[model samples]
Target chain A: MNEAEIIQKLQQGNEQAFRHLVENYQKRVVNTCYGLVQNTEDAEDIAQDVFVEVFRSIGSFRADAKLSTWLYRIAVNRSLNHIRDNKKRKWFQSFEDAVKEKKAGLLHYATENPGTELENLQRANILHEAISSLPENQRTAFTLNKYEELSYKEIAEIMDVSVASVESLIHRAKT
Target chain B: MNCNTLHTKMIFFLEGELPEREMEEIKIHLESCTDCAAFAEEMKKTLAVLETDKTPQLNPFFYTRVKARLEKQAEEKVVTQRIPVFARILQPAIFSVLLLAGIYTGIKIGQPAKINSDQSVYTENEMIPYLNEMEAEAIENFLME
Candidate 1:
């Protein structure tokens, strides 16, 4: 079915249409969140929230942009919010405990060089921390460009900014 | 280009985003500048680390979990909507009871003080009764005149 039909069905509370949306955009939303948050479980949780919000507030959607664009916007916003919330919540924990919690949240990836797995994980954490340190817009633009492999134009559309602004954001993020 | 300009352009240069002329210029600069070359290499490695971090495969039952959450939310919303209706009925009754209690407390608290003050006034008037009586008689006479 077309976007309009799905939107109408969702507004009417159709289970099948809702399933279709979740099935189609779940990976993109999850991965987009994972790119920003750099944690599998948190990304999936945030993605579920994104879908839940979309379903609950489908009436507010104007369809001025593609549903996927709207979904990406929500995913980015929710992921950033999750990060902010985590920072506040983590403030109460001891440093050692926070470090342990971070390490535990990281998953093991299969590496081409087997012994380099730990090294790679450390590097990944370092890179994730570096990206996380960036300001919100730069981080979002950089993550969208690097992690999601979105073109500059696409990132601009999702961020509701000019392409030049996105280019500047990514450039600043790298520097 | 200067090293500062090169640092800004380093990622774009590595990504092949610069124009051909600018790319050549940056290449020449990188070839000659040891500091710029090292910085570019480090930046390149950092960007490459992004590839090692694989996107995790989402759980198979993600939709199922979302559906459960939505169901819970819907149930909560139903409960929430129903609450206000009952509250609408109960609220005024509770408010009225509180209102009556407040007024009763105020009257109870003030009644003794009010009676004492009124008794003091009566006593003071009794103490000066003859003066008040003469003043009243004088006014009556003046009116009659």
Candidate 2:
């Protein structure tokens, strides 16, 4: 079904429609959450919460924007909130934890190529650190634009910011 | 066309944000200016490296787990909805049945019968002593005051 139809079914409290929505966007949500939270376990948890919130709020969803855009907004907000709450609990963990938690993770490169392992690990560590170190809004804009392949216009809507602001934030992030 | 203007536009040009008409001016400047060209090249390399870095893929079980959780939530919602319907239909019937059983048990217990007139009179008179005790206590306190 098209988004309108799917949304209609969702509003009617159709479980299958909700399922379809979840199936279609779950990967994007998980990936985006993973990017923000940097921890798979926490990302997964936050992603689940995002869907639950979406379903609960779908009745009020106006189709002024694309469904994906709306879903991305929900995912981004939830991820940010998850990070903020975790910070309050003094449980903040770095993106490196995510890389380390990967099965075979950074170690796979080390074991496969003993020569460049140190260099590879160092580069990956630097990149992850840089990404994590970015201010929240800039990091979010950059991630949504780069990793999620969202257009600047779509991101602006998701972030509720001007397209110009998104561009400038992304530019600053790149530099 | 000057170094400062070219430097400022480099990022926008690289991102393809500049208008088509402006592209030629930028291109002309880049051909004559090695410094600007090098800066653009460096920016391109940095952006390229950033783009080429792969985000980690979620585990294979990721979708499976999500689907499971959604299905579970959906099932729970359905169950929750049905609960009220069941209660609405069954509650009054259960209450009526319990009420009837209570009344039946009460009736099954025989009523008290009068055994003797004198015994009933004595029972009635027993409450007056307690009442008199309370009255006497109240009057004594009043008189003492």
lDDT of 1 by residue, B1-145 (tens): 8999898888789999889999999999989999999988877877777775545666899999999999999899898788776787899999999999999999898875446888788888785434577666887889889
DockQ of 2: 0.09
Q: What's the i-RMS of each model?
A: 2.0, 3.9
Q: Can you list the residue pairs that collide in candidate 1?
A: none
Tell me the tens digit of each residue's lDDT in model 1 across A34-80.
Answer: 88887777898999999999998998899789898999999999999
Model 1's DockQ?
0.34
Model 2 chain B lDDT-worst window of ten: B49-58
Judged by DockQ cut-offs, the docking class of candidate 2 is incorrect
Q: After best superposition, candidate 2 residue A77: deviation in angstroms?
A: 0.9
Model 2: per-residue Cα lDDT over B120-144, one tens digit each: 8899878653457756688788988
DockQ of predictions, in order shown: 0.34, 0.09
Candidate of highest TM-score: 1
Q: What is the lDDT of residue B113 in candidate 1?
A: 46
